[model samples]
Target: MRTPHVVVVMGVAGTGKTTIGPLLAGRLGVPYAEGDDFHPQANIDKMAAGIPLGDEDRRPWLDAIGAWAHGRAGLGGVVSSSALKRAYRDRLRAAAPGVVFVHLTGDRELIEDRMAQRQGHFMPTALLDSQFATLQPLEADERGVAVDVSGSPEQIAARAAAALDGLDATAPDAIAPDTTAQAGPSPL
Candidate 1:
């Protein structure tokens, strides 16, 4: 919404984080960062092998994304990550102040169907269950908008853009938070 508000599009696998992230960023005229780009080769290998990432495995990855967000402060960009836990979101927020989230949500059947239709992604449908288990929905206090994935990508992106711009009538709460004052990243 704001010029420097880092928007993290988060959700379990198959909720269209990758698909919508770029669209949202483009609509906002900001850079788009793929969360997968931050993962180490080892992590990718593990995921490709159908192994779920533990918190320890995610620490460095989260930090890298956080640091990127920190560097982009005041320039605003969109990034996509599962961000499946509250701690992970908190860490990201601490690293990049004024960060907001766009949570993609839907029924398991819809999501699993979507994942099954994908090809060449390191993350397989087999791990979707784990991803959902790990996902902690955005709390009411969190600065975010929960967009259901039932709509077309363009529809979702437009709604997200409008939400960020305080133009979304359906969900008026997506307005940007007051972020003139911000704190620096926390220690890793």
Candidate 2:
């Protein structure tokens, strides 16, 4: 059997984190969480009003997501977040040790086009520049894979799974010993 891995599907808005996260979790046979749901209503309202969130506004939200990830440390699960900065990723890592990140990346023009077409999302397309500016790609030492958002979600998830092939749980496969559920909160 193998220990379950916590996967964070991270990227800027419109990178399809929401769409791809659940599919990735399903592929991994784990639960899925929407990181956006972690944000307080105030944050949502701010974004809905076309206001970019300052770092202070994001701290509690980041902490909440980190705590959620921490709760799933030993079990496999997927969560989506716009983890756009190194400090943000560090905060998540601090809370959930060994959490692997799946960074969804793509060309600016392509992402903006997708954002322009999206509806009912709190994040405004106008803030796309700030997202790009804040983004810091995963470091070489990070346990993660950088996947291009150019492909379909299925393809992207497949690639991410493949990228994590050598990362099988140190303990045992989830199916072994009938321990499908490891240690973590129920899927959100």
Candidate 3:
């Protein structure tokens, strides 16, 4: 609801953060910062070597990204990050309070296919598994929404903007709950 909202596009690799971040920023009429840009050369090299980045490797990067996000938001700008952990999210929150995170969730196979098909990216497909394994999905109680990456990039960006702007009136019928006790769990 605040001006220059920071909407983080968080998820494991291949979740479309890089693609959607700029589009979302454009929609919001603000600059979008990619979290990957904060990564040092060493981290990039390790990822290029098909090695997963551990917490130690990510701490400085996350801090730098968070600092940038905080600074930008303070100056009426929006930023995006692939913050994969609750702790990392907390760090960003600490830096930019009330920043809304738009979590992009997808299946391993789906995202793996995306990574494999991706062109001119330093992150190799081999590191996808490690990212998935280390990823901690955002909590349901968090101040953010989870959107499944089951549609086109445009659809995903629209959903993110709608959620952020409160312009989406119709509820997403992505799932239907069963009222009858006999009915089993509704398909999510």
lDDT of each: 0.84, 0.80, 0.73
lDDT of 2 by residue, 82-140 (tens): 88887777777767766788999999999999999998888889989888888899987
Model 2 residue 124 lDDT? Answer: 88
Q: Taking the tens digit of each residue's C-alpha lDDT, what string does model 3 give over 66-110? A: 677667754544555667777777766666664667889888889
| Segments in model 2 whose C-alpha atoms lie over 4 Å from true places | 166-188
Model 2 TM-score? 0.86
Please give the lDDT score at residue 69 for candidate 3. Answer: 65
For lDDT, the strongest prediction is 1
Model 3 per-residue lDDT at 186: 16
Poorest 10 consecutive residues of model 3 by lDDT?
173-182
Error of 1 at 31 (Å): 0.5
Q: Pick the candidate with the highest TM-score.
A: 1
Tens-place lDDT per residue, model 1, 36-140, is 999999999999999999988998999899888878877889999999898788888877756888999999999999999999899999999899888899998
Per-residue error at 15 for model 3, in Å? 1.0
